[model samples]
Target: MEFHHLFSFYLTIITLTTISLFHSSKAVNPIILPIFKDTTKPQYYTTFLLGTPSLSVSLAIDLSSPWSWFTCNLVGFNDTWYSGVPNSSTYRVQRCTDDNSCAVYDSNYCYTCNSPNCKPKGNMCTGEIYPPSLYTGGSFYGGHLLAPLLLDIITVYKSNGPIPLGKRVYGFSFGCTGVDDLKGLSRYTKGVLSLARKDSNSFHGFITKAFKIPNKFALCLPSASKSTLNGAMYFGGGPYKLPPSKLDLSQFFVKTALVVNPIDVGETYGKRNSSIEYFVNIKSILVDDTPLKINSSLLVIDKNGLGGTKINPIYPYTTLHTNIYNALVDAFTTKAATMNITRVGQVSSFSACFSSKNMVGTKTGPKVPIISLKLDGRNEDIWRFYGFNSMIKVSNDVRCLAIVDGGLSVKASIVIGGKQMEDSLVEFDLESSKLRVMSSLLRFGTSCSQFRGA
Candidate 1:
């Protein structure tokens, strides 16, 4: 298949200044990455500048994925979309007999194969690493880090911006896989910008330590309806000041402890905590102030490493386990009737959809019964989903609840997807082990677009 999407995803970094390579930075400046909302799909992406000459490669945002990976030197893919890896002089495959092979780093599950006589010395090994497949709803990722100047295009909308790190930040780590890893990927995105918490080795952990910045990052996904406006990601730490008010958006944050589920007895995510995922404690779920009648145990991780809720930015919508979903759908449908919003046949994947003609539209989309996630916190610590966050407009006549059913047998009972997160400022504070969130940025009279390129 011809994989090109026929649209220009030529990054929007406002300006690309000549970066001073090998420069060490210890100044207190958080990095701002311009996260883009894909026009062709329901996804957000950020650009990665790699190779000696520098290439602004677009990668989709994957919150739980351990390492960053992309298609390199691949065939039948867009030239600009995939890495022009072979063209880089510094590109070196990690030798199997050396620092990178499975024998060396067992935590990442790196593997190698002998090329010729099967002797370790005579064989040419590709130090390949396997990433979690479930996060992307795809097969296991067979993809490494090394090569050239993995320079970042610095974006600072404020007076004080990200200061480039010394020599160490020059070499960013990632993997290069084949086309099969392209599952759950849009044609516009080359690969994933994995914000996985794989410590020091993963991009998030590496950048935080290398830059001497705080081990925290902020994510603000722009609305898909506002395709022109870019989303934003604040790496390092924050004071994420956006325009109009230029207020430090961080001040509005309300947080809950970020938990880590233990590794599976079986094969959940082998030796996880290395391939770790971000989980939040879901105490209960409510539709318009009424809690759903579902077993709360399904929302917690079990001894078998099953159940729990995760923040999945790449997924199009928040997903619930079957029982929870059924209860939610029933509650929402009943609530919609009270508001005179009559039900329509299910629109797309949404189990509970309503007629747009009966729905009341507001600045933040149509008014719907708010879906509140009562996380493990004080009674006031309810993360409410407003109209825009709870409903999706499939057509002029139909509006659907953005949440879906992830089937009975699923890893995370509540997978918080992209749709529910739009215009919401989410801060992942690794240092504090807490997820501080500011939901529905528009409700605050500010959109992420206050910063140019979003």
Candidate 2:
């Protein structure tokens, strides 16, 4: 498929609103990325400028995994079609020996001298590594780092002006894959921006420190049916500052605490903390006002720190435990029976579906029950998904519940996916240890026009 450049503007320094009191204005703005969906694949793509004379390349937005890389010719990946190297004087590699940041060095697919068939000829640094990540619902990534981690001037364009890495631009370390054992980078995209935690020098880490903002980021993904490939992601709170309008932007937000990982497990990410993933504690789930009768213990974080539900963008549909799924299906089907919404043959794997002929052509469908999530033991802090989002029209005549069952893996209980998050601004606040969900009603324009200060 052809890639299109959706956003084109220079970045500028904006007064940091969410930073500590000591620091003031910083070169910060939400690097707005134009989102494009792959009709065939259940994924979305965005573009970013990687080097000095900025080479624009498409990147898949993945939150479950970390470690982002692009194919490099020097690493022996010449056969692959990679967005060529950023020919700039400022570009350099972060050597393992010279730097002591182990957080940046560790990866499951890390290529060291000890790795099989990877014998370093001489004094080559073994620090440069790439970790293989296995997604629960998508492609299983397995690959090695061909060369040392690279650091260069990564530029992001915004409305105010070009917010280049001013004087503090030491560049960030990214992977350069040389080996070809895993699926090709082209299969996904030119590269991936694994939005999960990495070292202090990684993309999101660097931005948090550089701008002196809380270690948090937010994304507003539009509905799938919307024709325009429009969405917004903010590194800091810079882009979330909507201009004065009639709508109270703050009214849309629902706040909750992060599930506490076991003390022994730690938040080290790639290592023992793999089980942490992006799991969030679910206090309860309610259909309309009535709560579902599933075991609440299923939401507790396990010893491996892998309990509760993960609000993962990688999975297109929300998944629930078999017990919880059955409860939901029964509740929904019972509700449908009262509304006279005839059950059609199953669409996809979702068991609860209605005949499309009755409601597909019409703008309205049977009343969909409101689904609400009570977060982190807070009864009032609820994130609700309306009827329109809970049911999706797969074919012209078949409308199915967007949620699916996780089969028998009771441990992998729930995964709140993209469909539930559409038209909502979801924030992963690492510093505050909270997750905030903002309804789409706060969005003022199609492309965050007000966020650009337009």
Q: Estimate each model's TM-score.
A: 0.82, 0.75
Report the C-alpha lDDT of model 1 over 1-454, residue by residue, as the tens digit: 1222212123243421212101113325556565767655677787645564444467788876555667754422222223332555444443444434433322333233333432222222332333334344522222333211122222222214333321314546556566566666766666777686556446677677666678887888877534344666766666565555556676777779998877532123334442267888989899999999999899888876678888867877888889999999999989989999898897666768888887777766688888899878777777889998998778888888888887877766888988888888888989889988887778767776544322
lDDT of 2 by residue, 1-454 (tens): 2323323222112211112111113424443444444444455555555565545555656664445565544322221223433455466644443224434455323223334333221122232233333344332232334444556665543334423232334555566554352332324355555676444434567666655656777776645423233455666642244434434354567888766455212223334434334567788888876788998877776765545777766567788878888998887777666666678778667788876454422222235666788887556788877655588878876788888887765445787877777656687878777788865433344222123211
User: What is the lDDT for 94 in model 2?
Assistant: 44
Residue 9 lDDT (model 1): 26
The lDDT values for all models are 0.63, 0.54
Cα RMSDs of all predictions? Answer: 5.8, 6.4
Query: Which pairs clash inside model 2?
Result: 10-161, 10-162, 11-161, 11-162, 11-163, 12-161, 108-131, 109-131, 109-132, 356-397
* Candidate 2 wrong stretches, greater than 4 Å: 1-31, 73-89, 98-133, 137-148, 158-170, 178-188, 198-202, 224-228, 238-248, 263-270, 273-276, 356-366, 440-454
